[model samples]
Target chain A: MKTDSEIIITLSDVWKSFGTQTVLKGINLSVIDGKTTIIVGPSGQGKSLILKHILGLIKPDRGQVLFEGKDINAIQKKELNEIRTKIGVLFQNAALFDSMTVFDNVALPLREKTVASESEVREVVDEKLSLMDLRGSNDKYPAQLSGGMKKRVGLARALVLNPRIVFFDEPTTGLDVALSNEIYRFFFKTQEKLKYTAVIVSHDVPKIFKLADYVALISDGVIQDCLSPEDFQMSSNPIIKNFVEATMGTIYSSEAMEV
Target chain B: MLNFVEKLGAYVLYYVNEAGRMGIFLFFSLLNIIKPPYNKIASVLKQIYVIGSLSVFVIIFTGAFTGMVLGLQGYNTLTKFGAEGLLGSAVALSLIRELGPVLSALMVTGRAGSAICAEIGIMRISEQIDALECMAIDPYKFIMAPKFIAGIISMPLLTALFDVIGIFGGYAVGVGLLGGNAGAFFSSMQSDVEFIDVYMGFVKSVCFGLLIVWLCAAKGYYVHLERKGGFGAEGVSNVTTSAVVLTSVSILVMDYFITSMLI
Candidate 1:
């Protein structure tokens, strides 16, 4: 439904290489506002690298990453940081501060980027934590939490700022099937409610397609195609077909392909 | 011979590049400190507790033992020349001018500096630093500047504590156990130990504090870039060990330069 919406982020002919290994070669993609864009690719195929580029964590070897019609890479540091406050990122492994408690971890961005009073911070943190089903775990350190709990906390932290956009880098990499399903459910509910633009790099294959408005298949360091989940499942392109079959073939029940 | 020369050149270039990188890192870290929206006071206070208060027990223990040895040795040496009354002056001057700062720095390096390195190195490897950057939180301002401030604040105080405890330690041994005159001990120390001696120790402690924190924090911050820093837990461990060793060596080397200039 949002396919007709305006584009919020555009990556134009981005080229990035590390030493002798070229990771992203002349890749281009666009993210529509208030839509979930899921990026799927084989590991080490620079799937996560694309997220880093959009976030300005790493510079492309060449080309531009535009956010709301402005070139993020060419902007001033203060402006870039200001742009960053409007976007949230959930990295793989959660990346929670080991020294801070779960509550402080979630409250970090609000505390750092906003002038919210402690009571306001507590109110927001509590609401987010409750949504993440992390109530009563405020005093727990990241080391004390389970893999599923850490991911939920990470998601809570990412959402605390009510960012206009969010990027998830393999949010459920280590969770069990039930836990992964729970996280995906949380993702779906949050994305549905918040209506924020989302760019997720995931390995969950067919299951991930359920939450995607657009699915971009990346192979050989370039996006093969950006299609709706339904069209992606039915595409005849060999690369996309093989990728789909290779990932979905393992769990290929007739019903599982309908996402 | 040709291969040896090539390897030697490579080593020299690597060290030079590393030194340059560290200088730039320090420059940027200082810039972050002076920039607006300064680091929170609570963060600095927490660092003060970790770096200063936590190291108190070891500093006191080491300072006491060092002064006791100085008292026992100084008394023995001066008595040979019928100058036993000068033992208090010798112990007090040696402690206030040199041992207090250098030894205390080494102790804190072992206790707090290594932990700081390991903590930051772990955060680096774990992507916490990158996460902070993603959240628009300046990693240097949030994580590093506070530690630097804490180090500068704590080092002089710790060195002063070391000197005071050392002086009393010397008294406990010289007057109580060695049967030396208690009044002669205090009087000689008061007469011979001038303000310059105290000033020298303060300067050395402050300098050593900065060196310890700067080198340790930089080493950990750049662990990913180190040629042998590897990745994962092994990388953190290797970088932390190197940071402690390097900081200790740098403290000693900087001590000599400061002393040579002041003395």
Candidate 2:
């Protein structure tokens, strides 16, 4: 378990309900700084909801989301935006602008936020695109790219600002196994080189467990347990064990479980 | 019967809520319409080209036909009383005050408004707007304001073009085809049409512009939050239909009220 000093985000008794359907109730989570924390859970288990609250994209009906020691919900819009600049989000569909080329989509943040010259913006965009191994695809619009290429371009745009932390929403959901493995490897390599804190909400368990420093299991509007993947595999907690067993099959190799 | 009333009540409440939201959106858009540090100048000009310039051919086509019909109908009606000289004033007033602003606005609503709604709706569904918010960018100022400013600036100019072309179309039919005296046709229009009439037409066009853009933009922006299963293609279609229908109805309603007050 991470100590208090290392924690960068804390959700204190957060509850959110959409209409009469209660999605989250009394959810508490601690995300440590400079660590890859993977939120693993069943579909529709409020895993994505927790991510949005931490980013202040949505507010909880009750309780607080504290990011870097400040209550994000209570902060002013300007202050929230300043804090958001430190974070980047890779949406599930890549969300690349259909009208823009890959180069322009990646350059958008710099152009909008900073007064960087066109040449300067181009240099940064090129560096980030190359980092994502999307060099020659710059002139292509999103429609021309395959799913994996779109994800890479999306990752390139998210990292264009060199954010302090990055969030991924199901980075490997739709891709085939080989592409998924490649994405996982890319994420592993980039996060190592960039040293950005990572918070990923994904369902691809055995593979994702390989990248987790801390694995949190949330189910039924509450945190079931949070542990290192090895500990999660051995946990007696029924929800945690059930989630792992369901993903890895009952005859799982424990060697594949190590983080 | 009870279930039907319940559904009816829900529908009314839904429209009422939508109207309140649109009014507030227009209010904020107006407040920020001309505020500087206008970072989205390219976006604004793009919309101007789409909503204003690209629309010229359609406007010319609609204007000519409507004016031709007015000339033929007005000449026939006036000649019954041996007052065919009034055909010029009739055609001019009808084109400038009624068809110019109203038909142009309706055409724009069908052309540009549905496109705007669909585009923004797609942006919403695709999480592009959320991505903007995540990047510390204000989606409203970046997306909504530019379109509003462009539409407002575009409408009056298009209405003026519509009026000019429509009057020429009337001239072609009334004098050339029907053999009305050209001097009387041109002279009566100049004598009878006042400046206030043209000003009122311009005013209607401007108001109609604000209404169409506001309705289309607000419909698209709120599409994701719309509670009536506003998801996928069906949701966007609902928004587009509502935007186009409401724009036409509101333009006619406001035209009557504005003309009544002016007269």
Candidate 3:
């Protein structure tokens, strides 16, 4: 077994396709423990696809996805589930079950997977909700919450498991400035407190650069570069420079439209 | 014209392949049902609400009206033979043995079954189901099992409710409107109908319920990965409508075999 400080997730020359159109041409990257790796790219550059591959939601057509050096694609379904339990995901739309109350939504993963008593599940859920300052909203349904509140509840649900790895897919996509800042602060605090490795897929260049230790810039079905966020900023690559500069004008640009 | 024909042929071939994949998905779900990791109470409860409780009104309204119309028509035919008293037996027997369950299953398929397909389809499109898969929760256990069980349990119960309410509706039309004796109507129904008649309807309903849930969920789940073209809202809508229409047609087709066996 690798040490705790070693890379937890490694993707080697992974390829994915939808029909003849290749999305991830060949993605190679490693995510180390206790560090946040942000994947920034033009929209539809397969950033979300990479996140899905790590989660084992989709298997690569070629190459390997290694979690702690074991090939995820070759593992049995039950064992793969065991691997998945260690990772938490925050969807772009928050994706909370609209039919359920907030407490039940946050408690879903624990209640579904484990034999935890309702009281125990509630205790854990309440703790996470309180951490996100979402205490009183437990009785509310997802439809009742504003966009920021939904994201907070989504984060609380992701944290309820205390997963070893967490993925945030555009966590601040539609939030107001103040709420977005709050979400960013929550990310930093949660990472520091839990020391969990995070993979964030975002076009929010400033926030990602500020918060991520390692950043991978993908363009045209290939990872253009993967470097320390500081190093990425200092590089003269026109693709990276255009992306970083474009982030300042608008959160999304017309050029980044998925082909 | 050749290009158009080629595209049409390719589209039909694509759908045929999708149906094959959906068959494989159901086979796996059936396998999961017999194996371990059987905890699916939450999903079952959700399905009970979505498939059972939400479907009651439409079933009842349709059942009542279909019974009344059968009474009206059966009364007209029986009157020519001076067999007006056979109206209760005719309506109850047809409703309990065939129309009640079949009609209720059809209506519920249109209402709840379509919704289930659309909901799961949207989830697939949004990557929410994938999120669940990554969490190590078996999508079959977390999503499919509860719905399967709920469909099996609820469809028969709903049909039974339809049978009862439908008989009452026939009674209202025959005795209250057509001036037939209430006592005679009840006696005729009691004399003609057996527990086996009820049993046949319930059996058919259970099978149809399983088909609806399995086909709808399978279509939604498999359609996403199998989509050869670009994935979008159009793909979801196409699958959802096809699921509803296909399940409805299958219910009718299967109803024939079920009725023949029981007869």
Candidate 4:
């Protein structure tokens, strides 16, 4: 329904290899502003690698990663850090700082990057924690939190700065179906409210499809195709068809047995 | 012969590359320290407490024992020449010149250095470091700079404490136990030990502190690039072991060079 689609991040012919193994041969993708673009793939297909490239955590061997038309890899450290401030990342394991309390973890970026006062930091931290329904859990460390709670806290920290672009790497990876749905609902409400450009790499498959404006299938070190969710399911490309059918079949068959 | 030469060449290249990488890491760590937005006083104080205060008991225990052994041995040896009154000078000169700094450094390398490596290695493996990067905060400034400051400040103070405690231990063994002339012990030590000897100890402690932190932190920070067991809990343990061993060896080696230069 939103018509003003503008591209925010562009990965052009990116290639990467680690030691003897080639992880991404050549990856080209565009992330549109204010939209949820979900990347789904089999394991080791370079889905997370792409997100890292966009975040400047990894550099490509062959091509450029353009953020708002500036090559992130080509920029200086200060500029790159400046660019990173506009971004948020939710790692698969939640990756909260173990030494810090939940409040500190959520308030870190604001304190480090902004000129916010202590009172301002407290107010913002409280607001973000409340947003995640973690109002009373600010003092708990990551080791004390459950998986679902950690995930929610990770989201809270990610959105604390109100970053323009949020990257979720397997956000619902270890959660049960009910928890996954609950997380998705949070995703929906936050995205609707904050309007952040979301680039999520997930394995939740069909359930993840509901949150995506566009779905990209990564396979064999390249994106096979990127299409709308409805068209992705109906994609005639054999790779996309096989992936969609296999995942859907697995989920549906498992559900039927339970029923 | 060709295979042996090939292996030799590989070993040489690997060590050269690693040394260069370590040098670069130290350079950047130093550079980050001098850059703006310095670490908070509280963070540095916490590291000082962890690296300095926590190691006090061990340093005292070891220093006392080392000096007592020196006193017992020196008293017996000097008695041969009827020079047993020089016990205090012998103990003070040896401790202030060499043993105080070197032994204290080795202790810290075992206690604080290994723990620092393990902690940073765990953080590296867990992606907490990566998360810091994603948040646009410099890990060097946030995590490492405080430690470097603490190490530099703590080492000299710890070395001083070790020397003082060791001198007392020697006095107790020589004058109290052996019934040596207490006035002669104090006078000989005062006359023989110069400021330069104390200066040498201070210099060595500072260098040893920097070396311990630099090597241990680098080893842990780059745990992902470790050659063996670089992906899990195994990786952390392997790197921590290497860090402690490497730092210990380097401390002894550095002590020799510094002594040769300054002495």
Candidate 5:
């Protein structure tokens, strides 16, 4: 795990709402460089919203979203683009460009954002594709790829730019157990090779515990707890207890209600 | 009575809100067009395809039929005064001055305008627009500018083609098919129609094209958030429908004023 001095992202008292419904409330968190931080929460608890805010896709209704200790909201459009060039996002459904091929999808940001020569883009794309074990399927469209392959292709695209921060929104959703494990392994290997900060949002508790150095649990529009996985595992909070036990369909105590 | 008035009032408010949103989108699009990060080649080519090539056949077909009908009808009206030679001139004047540009604009509005809105609307709903923003790509420069340039370029060119085809159709019916002297028919058309008529039509087509593309793209992009609670395919469909209907009506309304001033 990386040290606190290398914190890459910080959200201080952030709040976001959609009309009458508040998605996130007073959320404060920090993501450290070269370590994976997993955000685990119940469904519809604003995990995706938080990820969107971090990516600067949506602004917070109030408070600051700082990347490398500078407020991102105040940056102009051109400056924002520079900041965005250094970050990669993996959406829950792997929002691959439907108009582009697998190779083109991975090459899009490189072609548009950077001044890389054509050969450079080809080499980088091929290298990322090989890293993701997607070398032979470069010509395939997103629709042609399997769910696991789509996730991997998404990861390849995210890593193509070699971003300082990589965000995964439900990386293992709708995948089989074996495929999900493969995704986690790819994630860990990718982090080790690249040494970038990874902020992952998932409900996969076992995998999250295995991969995450730090975990944040959100519930009812607020972050309930942010702790190390081992500390989180040993905590006496019934909410956390219900969540961990519910995954295995086991009750820790007769008195504890299901989440 | 009160319920009917309330419904009418709600409809008015809805349309007003949509117009406001569209106005904001156009403001941003215009700003982006004058600024840097251009993507000039892609923008110009997309406009050529979307506005120009796609609209050609529809304009030609509509123009040919309209001219033929005008020739046939004008011949009947002028025959009572032994003025059958004037049929070609009547068709040429009506088409070049008004019907050609207006009808072509309406046709392209239905075909290209609705499509622009639907495509952009679907992207907005699917978070493709958000994806572009995250990548630091301006949605306006990437999406709207090409459509805007295409709309302006395509409409005037299509209107010009419509005028030419409609006049040819009139020539076929009035001179070759109708047993009128080709020399007399053409002489009347040339003598009656001025370059000012063509210029006026071109101006109207340009204005109509801008309005249609701006209104459609703006409505689709902005309406996504408003429909977030119920956001889905249905929301996108509703916005697309509104974009088409609103653009069509606005084009016609603006056409009246532009024509009056030109005349």
Candidate 6:
């Protein structure tokens, strides 16, 4: 939707498959800068696979994942790491380090990546956890927290570095509707302050789109539609129509309202 | 028939790949150990605590019993040969050259090797490893090198402890319980058991330490997730089993080659 916007990453003619099943087939997509691009898809579809390519976690069998005009596959290890520092990812499972407490888990990036003093780390961690509504849970371990709390802590960790971009994998998974909306508002407020692009993939279609500047739906190893939420809701494609209908029961477009 | 050949070929290739991969892993882990910022003192000590200190009781238990059995058996055999004065030499040589290192290796393999495999494998499946990569921390250097360095340092120390305890256990049984002369037992041991025998045990202990820690970390790191026993809890368990079994058998097999060469 933001065609003139600067693109952070582009997947051109990319293809991937697992064993006998093809997951991504000749995909072409671009992520606009400073805006939220929600990659909405069915469960077990190639959304995570696409996210992996963007993060340079996995290379496509064909084509390329280009980040800031450089092919992630062709970049040297040092160069790739330089690119990685600018990006943060929230995995589907939160993936907190079990050996460390919640405080240590969030403090890991600061300790590992920066030369900040212990007091500085404590101060940053305190602010981030407070923003994520996880101030008092620092002493607890990841194993003891609920899924939603883990997701919040993961968000805090991701934002602690204030990377230029962050990827959220199912950020609203276990939380109720109210909590998901509250988390979204919190994330937006942080985004407004921090000014970073975010790309998220979620199955929580209707509620998740509330934060999206663009919604891209992938199915059958191809992206079927990439449009604004209103345009996506009015997509003529049957797959998108069925998905939107199933998740929303009924769809009304702003364009239709304008008409 | 073609399918069967293809399957056989694939299995063989898989093993060859794994072998080559393990070889590279060992090389890198050891290489990173010497080349670095050199600030792993805390991590190395933590590993030593796990690999050396925590494993004391088991090592001592194994050493004591092996020595007691040797004392009884050696005395019985030497008396029949009219060489009862040689009992201490026989027990000392046996403990210092073979039982001490081999039993310590096996016990450490069970106590520490399986644990290293499970911990690394769990980290892999849970995306903690990926998180480390995302954070630009090399899991190999950060996670594995300490285990290797600690194992190399601790195995010999543990083996020496085992040897000492076994000899004492032999003294307890032979000199106090049995009718062997304490002077002959202690004096004969002092004269007959040279420094070389104890040196051989130390060398073997170091080798076993390298094999156990390296193989366990490699197995856990590269446990193939695409295969049935390659992901999740089942995968970690399977890899841990293989690491312990493979490392134990490897130590035993290499012990023969090493002994053959040394002797």
Best by DockQ: 2
**All models, DockQ values?**
0.78, 0.86, 0.56, 0.82, 0.61, 0.67
Where is model 5 chain B poorest over a 10-residue stretch in terms of lDDT? B222-231
- Candidate 1's displacement at residue A245, Å, is 1.9
Model 6 Cα lDDT, one tens digit per residue, B92-117? 99999999999999999999888889
lDDT of each: 0.89, 0.88, 0.84, 0.90, 0.83, 0.87
lDDT of 4 by residue, B122-206 (tens): 8998889989999999998988888898999999999998998999899899888999889999999999999999999999999
Best by lDDT: 4
Per-residue accuracy of model 3 over B1-263 as CA lDDT, tens digit each: 99999999988988788778878778877777777867457667878888999999988898888888887888888999999988889999999899988898999889988888887887788666776775676778777877888899899989988988888888888888888778878899999999999899989999999999988888788666544432578877888888899999999999999999888
- Lowest lDDT sum, 10 consecutive residues, model 4 chain B, at B222-231
Superposed Cα deviation of residue A190, candidate 2 (Å) = 1.9
For model 5, the superposed segments whose C-alpha errors exceed 4 Å read A1-4, A248-259, B1-17, B226-230
As for candidate 6, its clashing pairs are none
- Classified by CAPRI criteria, candidate 3 counts as medium
Model 1 lDDT tens row, A115-210? 999999999999999999999999999999999999999999988888899999998898899999999988887887787889999989888998
**Candidate 1 lDDT tens digits, B80-116:** 9988888789998999888999999999999889898
Say what the RMSD of model 3 is: 4.6
Return the TM-score for each candidate structure.
Answer: 0.94, 0.95, 0.90, 0.96, 0.91, 0.94
Enumerate residue pairs that collide in model 5: none
Q: Which tens-of-lDDT digit does each residue in A99-167 have in candidate 6?
A: 889999999888877889999999999999999888799899998998778888888888889999999
Backbone clash pairs for candidate 4 read none
Task: Compose the digit string of candidate 4's lDDT tens values, residues A165-197.
Answer: 999999998899888887888888888889899
